[model samples]
Target chain A: MDRKNIKGFLEFVYDFYKSMKAHEITLVYEGEITHQITKAFTSLTESNMAKEEESNSVQKKVFHVMVECLQNISKHADSFGSDDFLFAGRGIFMVSRGDLEYHVTTGNVIENSKIEELSKILDHINSLDKEGLKQLYKTQMREGRLSEKGGAGLGFIDIARKTGRKLEYHFLPIDEDTHFFVLTSTISRNE
Target chain B: METIKIMGTDDTPTVILDAQNEIFEISGRSLPEDVTAFYDPILQWLDEYSSSPNPKTIFTFKLVYFNTASSKLLLDILMKLEQLHEAGNNVVVHWYYPEDDEDMQEAGEEYADIVDVPFEQIGYTLS
Candidate 1:
């Protein structure tokens, strides 16, 4: 291989390893986000989190957020047309443990047309305080109809409620018709 | 009516609806991949029980965790119980949460506020 290509590959590996060590990342999965994969990810996370000396409440919060994040990938990830990637839904999921918090992050591809709706939802969620989020969650639960995919449209709201933190998200343009979406939520170690 | 008992799975909750014993309980995690398919049977059982509910029906929810999709079905279940209670049957809901989980407790209160059914909030430490 060319010297530049070799250098780039080595740099990618080095950066990945550095980040894993620096962030204390417990788990990382980057592949098709199928139902089976989600289950396996969760079970693995449950065992890993159990190993840590954390309260049951904190463990539950992290687990719940992780589940929602993985489900989002499975439900929304758009298929890439390349034959090399034949998975049903492709995404990246990771969990990192900080000194006083746990962070869950996920990324997936979505149609560009969905960007506006998703941006609005995230903006609304970011605007709300804890009480506002709770109220909105209840209202959505009582009045909102389930989506065609069977989601109650309360995933983001529930995440906000559970974490009591603003959701960090971004949409990067991938093509004229598609964009990559990334979302992150954090759970504090303290009650 | 016949008892509707469903064993819990890694992704779904355990459900026991015994009309004879007057015990209705759903406990454990509930985030099934196919929420509609998972909850359809329970809803049908509730529909059947509505016709001839017991004198006093106490429905208990001891869910450790549930997804957003499952939340919709939970509301449907609570609404059904509300209808049953309004029809002059004595129906009450007991929502149990981990002692420190204010989120679940608030969820119970939200459901109680939306539905006319009486709800009792119970907090217990998980063993």
Candidate 2:
């Protein structure tokens, strides 16, 4: 069937993950992406046993960041229904690993028209190192609007800064109306 | 002028805004299901506090985390305090944040810029 490539892709992914030594594993989720937002976060927390040993300070910060990031996806993603405000998706979320870090990846469906804006924001945030992110975070937090449901578009930037990792992204065109946006970030516990 | 004390929840912060005492404190996390309900009374109390100026008003915000809506309401609250200060009332914001947390500290600094009151950033030793 013409689905061979998709099947192959799945096989490769399976083999790749089977080779890794992940401390925690989460059930793969499919279908409407919004419901998976919380699942993605839970997966991260579940997999990272080190998370428990983490200092209360780190735990609090990570918890805060997790909530903010999940909300961000919900705010930006395309969805249908009154409960849409409470959930997000049309995306995929998974956690994988490297040698010394855990990776969190979330993919969501977005309007193709907004790709340029999203790219610009990602590039701008990526360009800023720690200090620059701090300055930007402060600037946005102070002057940013509060009445809105989303942060001053600073949530993702804040995430990149806090994680101390470059945000990795991919845009796969799903169709004329929508595009799949992927965001991959790593949180490093080893310094 | 009323006293409202809502203890901090897993999702929201403790809100202690006493109109009579002129002590406004919001501490802990803030990501309430319905932010309007949680903030409505606090906003109303601030209105009263502004009307009959207290000799000294201390606004303390020690939030571990707050979402966007809470952030806006925070600005509204700060602006009210600024008006109080402008009206020749003694208003001071003693903002405290965890020492290593640049986000919270910067948030305090941002508020300091917009409001005319004296804003101090106090870093507590991590406990």
Candidate 3:
């Protein structure tokens, strides 16, 4: 290995580590978001949060959103190419702790055609207050049919209701038929 | 009717639906990946129990946390119990939560609002 190239790579690694420490990124994973992965991640976060002496409500809120986001990726992520079929269910999940708050962010590949419907659901959720979100949640549960993936379309709404804020998201174009979707939800450290 | 007793795990709740022994409750956290598969048998058992349900039935939900997927199935469970109540069986749903976890109580209240059954909210300190 070239000494100069190795030095440059080490510098980059050092910068990344510092950035992660600055943000208090406690957990991060980037790979196929399978059911087993979701279980393990949430369990790990639960104990970690407990170790930090976080309040019960804050831990639950973060835990709940993490599950929804992780499962959201597993249920909805799509493959980028035939050669990378495993990437079909791949995504990135991270948890960062800041003063008085914690944030859970997830990113996954989604079909461009599916963007409109998903955005509509998110936008509708954004327009609602806590009471309205609760109504939407109950109505969806009572009347909406579960998708083949076994979701009653309650993930986004539930997250919104729990967080009591609009979902922060972005859809970056990747190709003519696919885009990368990122979602972040914030929870206060104290109730 | 045979009782259904499934032990809890890290991701699923402990379910005990015993009629002969007069103990019926589901407790613990729930975020099962295939929520339908986990709940199908419980719904089906409630269906069977509906046919010859005891005269007085008390179903307790001691869930600490559940995901949106499990939330949907929860309504199905409550609806099943409502059916039993409608069929002239006296039914009461005892909803338990950690004293500090009011969200679980609110969850129970939402289900109570949606379904027409007597629901009693009980809170216990976390152990």
Best by TM-score: 3
Off by over 4 Å in 3: A1-5, A83-86
lDDT of 3 at B48: 94
True contacts kept of each: 0.83, 0.34, 0.90
Scored on chain A only, each candidate's TM-score is 0.86, 0.70, 0.92
Every model: Cα RMSD to truth: 2.5, 5.2, 1.6
lDDT of 2 by residue, B1-127 (tens): 5688899976679988776665689999787755667777887788886888677888899988776557766777888888888888888898999898776887788778766788989999667
lDDT of 3 by residue, A1-191 (tens): 59999999999999989989998898888989888998888888889889988887888899889999998888888887666454677889999998889999999999988899989999999999989998999999999888998777899998998888789999999888889999999998867
A1-191 per-residue lDDT for model 1 (tens digits): 69999999999999999989898898888987776887887888788778876787788888789878887887778776667855546799989888889999998888888889999999999999988997898889889988777777788988898898999999888888788899989999997
Clash-forming residue pairs, model 3: none
Window of ten residues with lowest summed lDDT in model 2 chain A: A21-30
Who wins the DockQ comparison?
A: 3
- Candidate 1 CAPRI classification by DockQ: medium
Error of 1 at A169 (Å): 1.1
Q: What TM-score do all the candidates reach, one by one?
A: 0.92, 0.77, 0.95
Candidate 2 lDDT by residue in tens digits, A51-107: 447554444445555555566565677652355463344456555545455556667
Candidate 2 docking: what grade?
acceptable
Ranking by TM-score: 3, 1, 2
lDDT of each: 0.88, 0.70, 0.90
